[model samples]
Target: MREAYHKELESISEALVEMANLVGSAMGRATGALLDTDLRLAESVIDTEGQVEELQRNLEEQAIAVLARQQPVATDLRVVVTSLRMSADLERCGVLAQHVAKLARRRHPQHAVPRDLRRTILEMGQLAQRLMAQAAEVLITQDVDAALQLERDDDRMDELHRMIFQHLMDERWHHGVETAVDVTLVGRYYERFADHAVSIARRVVYLVTGEHADDYLPDTPVIH
Candidate 1:
């Protein structure tokens, strides 16, 4: 029975990794749809979001069952609880990807991103995907160093998000208010997606090290 309980714990970890992988792929496809204004791809992303949601629900159910039956302790307990939070973050990441896809579908042939800003948006999307992929690695490997690196990586996404707002607020901007709003929303979605990736990585750090990321002092050894 103990062996079975441990196996269930491992399954939870696997599910979290799977969630991360799914959300990462969703963001990548959503970015393509956004850049190319591909309605079909956008529709594909929108339709598949239910898969992410279903995965989250299944994970939660399994986690709750483990907690009730096995009553995990110490690291085992952390694994189950952290997996729950990480799944929540992954679910949110999936939703953000869907939002990006919907924006592409809404804009249709016109393209949601203007040509001048497409490069920045593309960079944001790529960064978001990379961060999520790294987060998944951290989840599976429990590599605290890689998890910490995700925080640094998120800085780039934040920079790109600021760049988008700067262009929108520029007095010389040619795009109308509607286009500006669309760009702003899209930038926010990418930024939040990166944030969720970082959050998941942080949770992994906690699971591995038993140290909450926020508890560290600026020059602490664990962080470096």
Candidate 2:
């Protein structure tokens, strides 16, 4: 029975990893659609969001079952709770990607990204996409070290996000106020997408080290 219970727990983790992959792909495609102003691709990315939602619902049901039937304790208990939190993070990542796709769809024939900012926006999108992919890998491997790296990547996303504001503030800016508002929203969407991915990684760190990533110093020797 204990063996079966543990297997169910593993299944929940597996679902979370799958959610990561789903959102990662959605973000990549959304970035492509945004950059190219492709309505078809944007619609496809928007459509895929339902899949992410389904995965989250299924994961929740499985987790609740484990908690009620097995009554996991210690590490097992932590695993179940963390899985729920990570699932929410992954689901939010998908929502952020959909927001990107929606922006692209709204812009339609024209580029949502101004010409000067295209390169910066592309880099931000790719970085956000890669962060979620890395988070997925961390989930599968349960590697605390890899999970920690997501934080650094998230810092780079923040840098790119700030760069967008600089462009809007420049004296020669020509994109107009409407485009500026759209750019601001796009930058925020990518930034939040990366943030959710990092959140997943931090939860993984907690699962492995039994300490929050902020508090746990992997290099320090324990006094006890």
Q: Compared with the true structure, what per-residue lDDT tens digits does model 2 show for residues 1-224?
A: 97898789889988988888889999999999999999999999998868888899999999999999999899989889988988989889889999999999999999989888999999998999899999989989989877887787688899999899998999999989999999999999999889898888888888888888888645644332
Q: How many backbone clashes does candidate 2 have?
A: 0
- The most accurate candidate by lDDT is 2
Residue 194 local lDDT, model 2 = 90
Stretches of candidate 2 off by over 4 Å are 217-224
Give model 1's clash tally. Answer: 0
Model 1 Cα shift for residue 83 (angstroms): 0.8
Q: For residues 1-224, could you state the per-residue lDDT of candidate 1 as single tens digits?
A: 98999899899989988988998999999999999888898999999968988999999999999999999888888788888988988888889999999999999989778899999999999999999999889887888778888887788898888899889989999989889989988999998899999888888777777777777424455433
Model 1 CA deviation exceeding 4 Å by range: 220-224
> Candidate 1 clashing pairs?
none
| Model 1: lDDT to the true structure | 0.89
In Å, residue 182's CA in model 1 sits off its true spot by 0.5
Looking at candidate 1, what is the lDDT of residue 14? 92
